[model samples]
Target: MFAMSNPERPVRLGFVGVGSRGTSMLQTALMLEGVEITAISDIVPERVERAQQLVMESGQPKPKGFTGEEDYKKIADLTNVDAVFTATPWSLHTPVMVATMKAGKYGGTEMPACDGYEEAWELVETAEQTGMHCMLLENYAYMRNVMMVLNMVRHGLFGELTHCETGYQHDVRYATIGDQGELLWRAHERYLHHTGNRYPTHAIGPVSQWIDINRGNKFEYLVSMSSRSLGLNHYVAKNYGADHPNAKRQYKAGDVNCTLIQTANGITVTLYYDSLSPRPVDFIYRIQGTKGIYSGTLDKIYLEDTSPVPHQWEDIEKYVEEYDHPLWKKYGDIAVQTGHGGSDYLCMRDFVEAIRHQAAFPIDVYDAATWSIITKLTEESVLNKSKPVDFPDFTRSKWRERKPLPIVNS
Candidate 1:
């Protein structure tokens, strides 16, 4: 358990982008004691003003507000801020975080922190050079179910973890197109024809922790493939008719992206990213070991030679309750009210703790960079005809000897 350096002095945070995700993150932060929103910045004036009102309404002093494209820099550079949390678009994550680190403040950025390998490596170099903390706000890594599995894996209940699978299998066709039926900048991405697992870390984060990836084990190489871009068009045609402008629009993102990864310790992981598909939200996480297997979707568990009914699956709820991640056991209720099925609050809590302690956070710069680089690696593999792309060693060589921080106190 980590404690704030000066427990009496409240942690000051400067937030940029008070839109959908940012608003939720800000609200969660507001709920925690001894935290203050000192400044809020966003490109939209209304969002900035709304965040200012939220902070004032929460009994905190009115936070300074700024609106414009580059105003986040002002917030990041504020001397009073202990940390900077940016929930902006994907392309801006790296730049904003890099700026925060250079300014000597902790930076917590939204997921897929970087779009490609080079930018992720840049973050590594910057964090090391500045000796600043930059964490990936990977909410999935903090989910109660995922953390429970992590605890189970650490206790050796699953035996030696051999291979695992995880993915972001959600239907976001509505978010992509929006209600107006116009392709926003976010959706325009789907209209392009590039291949690879564009988003890999959401699924990889919790699994990496379960298997101690980036610590003793490191991802080696990845082979990726993507189905043609047809899901979005199919959905548009089905609902909006073939004459709908979007139905005729060219989509570049594949219908589905499946990737295979092999770690240095001979562990295999399968990942998926399928946002355009018309399907219910799915987790598709499977933890496989020599002795047992667990499924996130089915909430089912099967162990070799150790079940009341041979070859029959049993409910995993008992295991989850017994081995729930200690972090969640302590704060699951608070997290649940915040968002993302209780993970968002935990993720924010860790980020704030890391900032206050100025110590190695649960997800350090190395984890952020390593997990983020998978996005670019997958793109390369897809463009190269599903050829294997070797993953980068962001740590130089520290991974083999690095030990993971205790995620759950046994």
Candidate 2:
């Protein structure tokens, strides 16, 4: 069945930004049957060489490597590469994706596809103008539990979703600061001067899928508030010296940011960004509806009519065997061997399958813009004392006519 959709050979891929995340994704891509890593690009020549070695070790010919700072554009123009996937830093995602789309190749990018309104609109407009799909490879959307919840939602188990609360709640002090107390790129660029949900896509992506954002419904507006900036300072002071520059520096970003959003269809969402705080990872994918609710923190579910006991949360595993998404049901064995609990594998498969079959990507450019623009929107609201900020209609009214994403086994 999967083979029938393809009218051509394997999908040739060019990878930009072969850093840690990019190399990890490249490894995942290598696990697939019909994916060819034809080219690799990174500013660091050593990283490019390492990625090419990984490709060669996979028994394929060594992929051509490009090491110029802006060599991603060259990968976009490569004749052998049919699609380009970038796992560059936040600022580079839009540029690489835009270059790929302009070159008329399929583009796949890591989360928060663009940083601000201008780049968000640019992503939307470029995809529309070039007739190419730029997929936001939001692997979180393909998570097993979330995919099961999505299936349950589609089957009316949730019955008219009313609200959702999700957030990127992981603490990443190590990533933000080097061991020598130097500010990392994330600290320098995102947290040093930004004061809102610097990274919202990880938490919002799956919820957006569940709520059908940018499909039949749109994010209308939001108001955001942030706690005082203290986590990073405290971290630096505790780990380094009390008089360290980082400890004394005033970070514009707060330790915790809370945002409230209303969808055009009347569903409400509560988004949080609490990465600076010292805490374990928690996405809090709490989706509530008239019929039932799911709590990702507890990994439990409750239903008014279907639960064995009234007003009690049942283990989500109870329904997993019956409610598991078809994609997981088909590929669980192999996917579990990869990253992010196999989401990386499934997500890459979706990208390759879409390219091979010339089908619309599951997460298109409009969805990318809608989910990613939250960074800028929340910043605006926080800077203005939690004033309501309207979301730009990236689709420009086309969302009204678009159908919700359909369940796909392939």
Candidate 3:
């Protein structure tokens, strides 16, 4: 662990892939105390320069910049950098993380962290061999309602959790196609050729924490199916001429993909990916247990013992207020100014604090692999008549002995 012996020392950071999302996270990092942006890299030299300007505007020295396709390796090797964070394209996430860990620096990446089973296994094996941490900066896990739910779960308010239903249900058709009706990277990488839960980490990350996945329990297997692909074809044909090549292109990704997972402890989870359809953004975070249930879609709860009336849903605001996570309670006001309803700030804070103190990350590589591998697993299952796919035990049976995540009050 490369901890600063003095906690007051800044956690120097190098950032890779400084596009829109990366730049936003850079701005968020600048809000943190005792953090130094030491270096920046992006395929676009303009983005590298822009990120450097942001760092300089923050009153820090202008960070060194790199723009080569493989420049992240250079950032990983810098002696001044204590950690490296990458918000690169989906295919680049695992490579950047692997490079950083091999260079003996903590690594953080946005979203699924890795897409394929090979990449997932490589991530787990690399972290174990190097004794370095690679965290999936899954911001959803820190959202206000989800964190409160995690707190309630830990406190036994949701007694003996038996089931959960969560999904990433957002329309991103505009993002997939350019104004000129050209295919974007997401269209090629996620929708054009693959089908299944392409983006499951956002939904599964929070659910995993609540169910103690990779801690006291682990995902055993899952079966998945997907609806026919139609949203993108309709979107393209409507916006552009019906004869446009994009409108006629065959997309493999189904508009709605569903996967049902069973945990070693017998908890069941229904996960969904519905980005192609026109819809409001709803994570559909529903958790049920022996005593009560909470519905994130409705933002309501039904508790058998605690409710004043039985069998009726009540507003969850009071329960959230009563069981707010400590991290949220302490940082709510400041975090609200950042992205994703303050989850960005809180999640980044945890990453920084863990690095500063040389503490184990709340969401470590094992959890990252377990949650991220769902993409590939779901794809395999969907293509094979929804056959059951066993989860790779990234923990190697250690989950039976690992303790549940404690409420991180400090």
Of candidate 3, the 10-residue stretch with the lowest lDDT total is 1-10
- The digit string of per-residue lDDT tens for model 1 on 1-410 reads 11235756888999988899999999999988889999999989999999999999999999999987888788877877888899988888889998888888889998778877679889999998988878999988888788888877877878988988888898888777756466765675434555566667788899889888888999999999888888777777777788888888877678789999999999999999888887887777789888898888887888886756877888876676678888887887778898889888988888876676666678888898888888788888888899999988998989989986586422
Error of 2 at 298 (Å): 0.6
lDDT of 3 by residue, 61-145 (tens): 9999998999899998898899999998899999999999999899999978998889999999999999999999999999999
Stretches of candidate 1 exceeding 4 Å from the true structure: 1-7, 190-193, 239-241
Candidate whose lDDT is highest:
3
Estimated TM-score for each candidate: 0.95, 0.97, 0.98
Clashing pairs in 2: none
Per-residue lDDT of 213-293 in model 2, one digit per residue for the tens?
878899999999999999889999999989999999999999999999999999999999999988999999999999999
Clash count of each predicted structure = 3, 0, 0
In order, the Cα lDDT scores of the candidates are: 0.83, 0.91, 0.92
What does candidate 3 score on TM? Answer: 0.98
Q: After superposition on all CA atoms, how large is the RMSD of candidate 2?
A: 2.4
**Using TM-score as the measure, which candidate wins?**
3
Report the number of backbone clashes for model 3. Answer: 0
| Model 2 TM | 0.97
Query: What lDDT is reached at residue 245 by model 2?
Result: 94
